[model samples]
Target: MRRFTRPKVIPLLAKKPPSQLPHLSPIPNPSLPQPPQNPSPPSPILTLSHTQNHTHLLTFIKTHIKNPPLTPKTLLHFLKSKLHHHPTFTHLDFHVFNWASTVDSYRHDHSTFEWMVCSLANTARFSELGCLLSFIVANPCPCSDGIFSCPRTEPIFRFAISAYCRVGRLDDAVRAFDSMRKLIDGKASVVVYNILINGFVKCGEHDKALWFYERMVRDRVKGDVFTFNILISSYCRNSQFGLALELFKDMRGKGCSPNVVSFNTLIKGFFREGKFEDGIEMAYEMIEFGCEFSSVTCEILVDGLCREGQVEEACELLIDFSRKGVVPRGYDYYGLVEVLCRKGNSERALEVVDELWRMRNVPSLIACTTLVEGLRRSARIDEALEVMGRMLEVDMVPDIVTFNCLLQDLCNLGRTEEADNLSLLSSTKGLELDATAYTILASGYSREGKKKEGKVVVDEMLDMGFIPDLATYNRLANG
Candidate 1:
């Protein structure tokens, strides 16, 4: 579920951008692409002069290109800064890109080619993107003028293929890929194959993804870990967990080691089919394979077992993970504690938190608070007090309400001395105390018959404005 964040692009031309732009040599008289067959089709570029906006575009192009025989670099700059970045003329980039080819000496290099492609793809202008790709095929880069094809060519098509895949235009993607394979000097990179496979999978064409993966293999392209991960996920999604597992084994057999994601996906797949034991085993295997844990990995294991009413087993597995020292520092165990507490196994929850904390897997603040409340409800005042102290030692203070409640619990258990020490310690850790905190401590000391201690707290309370009225102040100090 990795979300792809497209880089911020120009404002308007995202409609259907090319992963690259046109260079002149491909086909003689390469006409502009026909607009898509939908309502409100874009005005054909040749017809731009008929519209009011075309006047501005024409003027801007004329103004920017006073010098003849435009170089690709200069033209790219003008297209990007003068038009791409223009507030009013941003969508007019393709027009100028085409117009630049008409210049006698101007030739589109990889730079303008890439810019135009990205612009078309960003705008989701697939049909135009296809034409642009065709134009590139007809007029290969100047570097390809010698025996070798342009190195930049594959990258441009790769970007274009990914863009096509993004829009579910797999045919266009495959067409672009085919054209690229014909032009590239050697085998298509595994990366290119992966994009198409992943694109097919994302578009819900599992069988096609598999077909493409097989083709990639036949091409003798060494499939990387990502290749296996995608197909593994695809098989799992198709209810072919057996195949997913087979691929998992095949992945390792091929000297492509499984990473955390590899294990996590299968573990999750196992759990999705209610194969809890298998899921847990997959997690342990992750550790054995030297793949470090992600927080989500732990979450999946814990949540899966808990769903099956194996809460204690979940607890043991996590403790084992913590002891194994594979738990990522970013992995938070709050949900486990919260679940255990809600299940009335507060002691087990406390044990889990304590064991992990002892190993320096500091429980998040909410986990500490939840565990403290769980302990409080069970009348485990001593453990609650100790948990509170540990939280402060780590500079994690509870909310004031929880803090006061714990203090009150300590006093109620005749541990007022411990309560007072805690109050002082907590303040140093940036735990703000209120009238209720001081009042609770003062009352605790009064019950313990230590007037001197009680008076000290009362005086402090008065200085801090907790003793609001004269009568309350006198009552607190004299108690």
Candidate 2:
């Protein structure tokens, strides 16, 4: 109380100087409702109703959006969500939508538009794509930048071209591509050009593809791995392996490294053309390029080796593949087994069967048949019988050819009783004992000077509706 009463009410010190006072923005009107902070998800103006008859889906689509304009975006969405998803829908739906126009929509989103084009193109709906394209040409969508450019248009257009190409509609594809050129200002994308090239390639129109490829380079579109791959594959498909290899060299010369697919294509082409040496060499080259040989590559090598009577080498390769913890593909075993049997390498063929068994992979019907034939060819009658017994035990019926081969081998080895038992088994197994089987039995009896048995076999053969050939008749008469 001493100085409080008289304490001068000195002016309160300002917490912040007027010069340093934080400038406050005036608050906006709180009364006005704020616009939505985020955009609403787009609602489908058109909803699909399920119907048993697919024509109803088309009818529903047509009725809801009369004169519906088609664009790449709309087409893409429709294809992905509607047409592709509902494959049960009638072709009439595709036909109707294919012809629909996208002109009603004043502005179409570019990505959606591109997707639609690609979708239609993918489905081979060229006629419908063509109609939409005509609309685009007449009424180009305006650009936001006011430049009136259509960069996205080219991709969609290319998709249409590819579709046309897929259906062997080369003329249509060409027309679509040419029209696409008019839409974009600068150079079209290499990807687009490659699509056209692939179209040509697919139709076995290699010349056309090559022509377009040259044009692509001339138009400054850079060639890529896919471009070369398409050309190589096309060449190989046409059995023009020489031309394909030449192109491979040229691709490398142009600084493009050959990919595994490229090499694999070439190897397959060589093998198909019976250029086994070249195929094998390319396989080695593939390994040198640090590319692991695929099962297909291995199959080709094994097949080539077998064809050249190198069954031992083929078997070794199979063993090596197994040791590397690689299960031989079904084709590999089938090829090796067939060749081994054909070349009278039954022992090796049996070893292969065992190896496949050890690897827990069952031999194919072809492999089994080949093994049986090989055993018969090499006069391994007992082994052939063992294989047949195993086949029956495993619920596998011996094919007619395999059964005939085994019967002949048994008769030739003077195992007439076993051959007769096999005949009974064949009839029981629903297999016909054809002329070959009876001929073998007749020959075996004749060689043993059992005229009564040989004559009985001949009468049985005639009763079975098989007309014994001169060779069989002569053998029986001589006995």
User: What CA RMSD would you report for each candidate?
Assistant: 8.1, 19.4
Question: For residues 28-117, could you state the per-residue lDDT of candidate 2 as single tens digits?
Answer: 344667456557542211222323443465454554444334455555456556655565543334333323322233244456556556
* Residue 37 CA displacement from its true place in model 2, Å: 56
Kindly give the stretch of ten consecutive residues in candidate 1 with the minimal lDDT sum: 6-15
Candidate 1, 1-479: lDDT as tens digits? 21133222222122222333222222113265645456865433422533456656666666886765568888888987778778877876776676565554346768888998999999987777777776677666666666677789889999999998988989989999999987678899999999999999999999999999989989999999999999999998899999999999999899998888899899999999998888888787777777888988989998888878888898899898889898788678888899888877789998998888878899898989999998888888888888888888878978999999998988898889888998899999998899899999999999999999999999998889776799998898777
| Top candidate (TM-score) | 1
- Whole-model lDDT values for every prediction: 0.82, 0.67
Off by over 4 Å in 1: 1-52, 446-455, 465-479
* Local lDDT at 304 for model 1: 83
Clashes of each: 23, 12
Q: What lDDT, from 0 to 1, does candidate 2 have?
A: 0.67
**At residue 474, what lDDT does model 2 achieve?**
62
* Model 2 regions lying over 4 Å from their true place: 1-105, 108-128, 141-152, 182-189, 235-243, 253-255, 269-275, 304-331, 353-479
lDDT, model 1, position 324: 85
